[model samples]
Target: MTGQSLLLIDGFNLLSRAHFATSYNRTDDQLKNSKGMYTNALRVFYQKIFNLIRDHRITHLSVVWDVKRDETARRKKYPFYKATRFELPEPLIHQYETCKAASDAIGIHQISLSPYEADDLMGALSKKWSGGDCYIYSNDHDLFQLLSETTSQIIAGKQGEYVYSLSHFQADYGIAPEQWVDVKALLGDSSDNIPGCPGIGEKSALPLIQHYGSLERIYENIEQLEPGLSRLKKKLIQGKETALLSRELSQITCDIAELDPLLMDDLKVSIRKDVLGEWLEQMELKIRIDSYGA
Candidate 1:
């Protein structure tokens, strides 16, 4: 907590937010550049990144991206994981490429690994940078499991940005941050297609986790559950396998071997002024370089 602060960005998370924010009601043609490509996401993405850097006084930065869904280990374990998501729009895909190029041009370190999601990379990096303060920028509730004394999550909401700390999580959930995976394991995540215990929702899941501490322990002491929870115990018994599988899918991988060699010094933010200016001109964005302290 005393060392330099690191900002870990959930790359596609921010891009999708920016894209939807600017293109909600507008047509593709309305946000295109002179070269006939969409600039809406790119402009907003750049602006948001710089704003966060300044707002947080971030000394280190890393934007993490997910590998293809089919290629990820989670999808391999559960083929239906995130299967309901639609393909990205053509305009948004173009902007994603442009944003990556711009990130490289500006010297923002970008990290990605095949067969691993961005969440895993962020978790690994947060663990690796444990000596420093790490702020994970994402709205994904799945990342809640990564919260700790030194690591926090930054959720960008409509009204403003809010930091979710470990204490805030403990107060809200009435359990340790690591226990969040068990909560998800009991209730499941519809967005990710993780099927938790059947017939159990947040109402049943929260209290069970708060009392039992974890999915494993809940099963270990299933027979000891109060008579008032007979129906809950039945559901847990029926969905034991599903709940265990869901926990595996819900938990973030924190000890990725590939990320072991990366050092904090590698993530030090050093924007390339000339490259950024040229890239912005090519993209026809009107953002002033001087505003970023170039």
Candidate 2:
């Protein structure tokens, strides 16, 4: 916790949040610049970045993006993965690309690898920067598995920003961070279209993972489970394959080989005030360029 802290952002996640935050009660035209391009999300995106850097005293920063949805490894493995989620709005899509360009103009490291997600990139980077205090800026609960003594997750909550640490995970879930995938495997995530164990949810998943430690262990001792939990045991037995697949989908890849060569020094924040001011002016964003204090 004493070393320099690195802030790894899930780019699209933050952009989507910014879009909703600024788009409320506003039409597409109202959110657009004079050139007919969207600026609301882009404005809020930079504002959040500036705020996060100032608030966290972030020494190193990186913005991670997801490749095309169809090109993702998860979608290739399970065609139905994330199929339920709606497509990004046209305005948001425009702003997303602008945000990436703006991030680069300001000298922030932007990462996007084929077949992997922002979550995976953040996981890989967090693992690579394990020597220091690394913070994953995202609202995705699935990233909880990456929590450790040196890594935490920053979530933008309704009240304010909440930082979830290893201790917080332990206190809230009463299970190891590594066991989160197992819990999700049993409980399922409707948002992501991950069909977890049938007839199983938090009520059953939590105790099963807390008691057995893992999905495999639960199955190893399946027959020995108490008679009072016979129904839950039966559900696990029937959903074994699904649960295994769900675990695979829920788990974040923390060792992307391409990210291995990326050193912490490469991510050190070195914003070019001149470039940022010019980019903001070009985008017609109303953000206070002076607040960045690059």
Candidate 3:
């Protein structure tokens, strides 16, 4: 444990949430000054996360991103995964690029790999981030598995009251934080279109897994489960390969090479006023300068 902490953002998850909330229609250079969806999103995200850093006494932080063009081939493994989501709007897209540049200019780190999702990157970094117990910044339940006695999760929210806690994750999910990924695989994730065991859900999977100990154990004695759940167990057997594969897919990488914290030692506590100003200018935001309290 490094004693120092890091705030890891699932970058696109936050970006997408901000983009739709404002019904934003972004354009290149439209957000050049940070008025664009991405800029505004980044500002709120940065401020909110930084505030948490201040609140929690965190000494280091970074945002993890999914740089792959199409979910890093997740679609290949689970073709319908995220197939229903809308395409990212142009302004929001541009802002993502600008946001990275802005965050970088301000000296914080932004980690991404082409074949991975932010969750994967976050997981990888969490395991190997060299910092003390890591705190992941998302409610992506998929991440719940990373929780521990000291590690935790923070649910980002628009109203500033996001849910957070490894303890909550464990209590709510009925297993230790380390078991969440496998638990999710057993239940399947609707948001990502993952095909978990058809009838198994958080309720059944958590307890069943808690009692049975492992998917293999559950499968080995499928006949002994409740009759209603027996049908679900069959489905689990049918999708056994997927149930297992999704677990693999959902497991965070914990080995990403780019998340080295020492690489972030140069980051300081102050926002770069010039970078913030330029970003705002690009967005055509007519902030009264003083409003920034600069």
Candidate 4:
């Protein structure tokens, strides 16, 4: 939790983004049938991620996935949340599956459990990471809550290859990562389809939450808020139950009941040169390494 470097990648996140980017540059019919020409995109992205892990010299590595979206946790909260993102183009969708296979062949572990998301899996595993900084390779803002307990950040922006450390998250958001849930609760998440206080955006949310320390507290003293915010508080009161429920739904769960990282002995391993070479050959990716570099 303190000084460890563990790479927790959101497998589908990388795959979907790669697919969309790959599709933009190449037509689907061409990519699947080409001389493994299109596989390079997936390879290059994985290679970059692999190199980042190598450069950081992580003690543990795990790729997290949302196996199926039909979890009791999510369905119980808001049935329609993330309903549409499930559909993805065929070429990139296939590539996402291939990437999982490639990761396995390379000895990197991919983790998924029933009803839990990759973010939650990372959060739980991150708690067990000992020493150094733990990183999550996702652009998902939900992960920011874990920053309170572990060194947390997301792989963000268009390419999503850039790693955002704790400081980088704060710099980008105008508030610390720990305050992310509060921020989301106030501003609401259209992506996740969680509704927040109708009028509260980042500007007003930060000061009110910072002053009061939590949404619950601010709501408890709704009468004393700034005149503008006071009017907005009425909206929060109406949706109070839903807002709190959304807050719970939005935060990544670090306490998974059944899964234990201690059982995973393959957590520490290096990617083999022969395996990497064979996969690259099959995928037809370029080698930045010399023939000897693997």
Give the range of the ten consecutive residues with the poorest summed lDDT in model 3: 285-294
Better model by lDDT: candidate 1 vs candidate 4? 1
Tens digit of per-residue lDDT, candidate 4, span 204-263: 777776677777788778878766567667766786776676677777778887776365
Question: Model 3: per-residue lDDT, tens digit, 9-99?
Answer: 7788777676565445754444434332435555555555556666666666767788654757576666677776667777678768867
Question: Per-residue lDDT for 1-294 in model 2, tens only?
Answer: 465789999999999988998899998799998989889888888888888888878888999999999999999989999999998899899888777777777898899999998889888888888447888899999999999998999998889998999999999999999899999999889999999999997788898888889999889999898565567877888999999999999999988888667777888889888898888788787777656444
Cα error of candidate 4 at position 176, Å: 5.8
Worst 10 residues of 2 by lDDT: 285-294
Off by over 4 Å in 4: 1-4, 33-41, 148-150, 158-163, 167-178, 261-265, 289-294
Best-to-worst order by TM-score is: 1, 2, 4, 3
User: Could you give candidate 1's per-residue lDDT for residues 35-60 as a string of tens digits?
Assistant: 89899988888887788777777888
TM-scores vs. true structure, each candidate: 0.96, 0.95, 0.79, 0.85
The runs of at least 3 residues in candidate 3 whose Cα sits more than 4 Å from the true structure, single-residue gaps closed, are: 1-3, 24-40, 71-73, 76-80, 157-163, 226-231, 257-274, 277-294
Winner on TM-score (2 vs 3): 2
lDDT of 2 at 221: 90
Report, for every candidate in turn, its global Cα lDDT versus the true structure.
0.87, 0.87, 0.66, 0.69
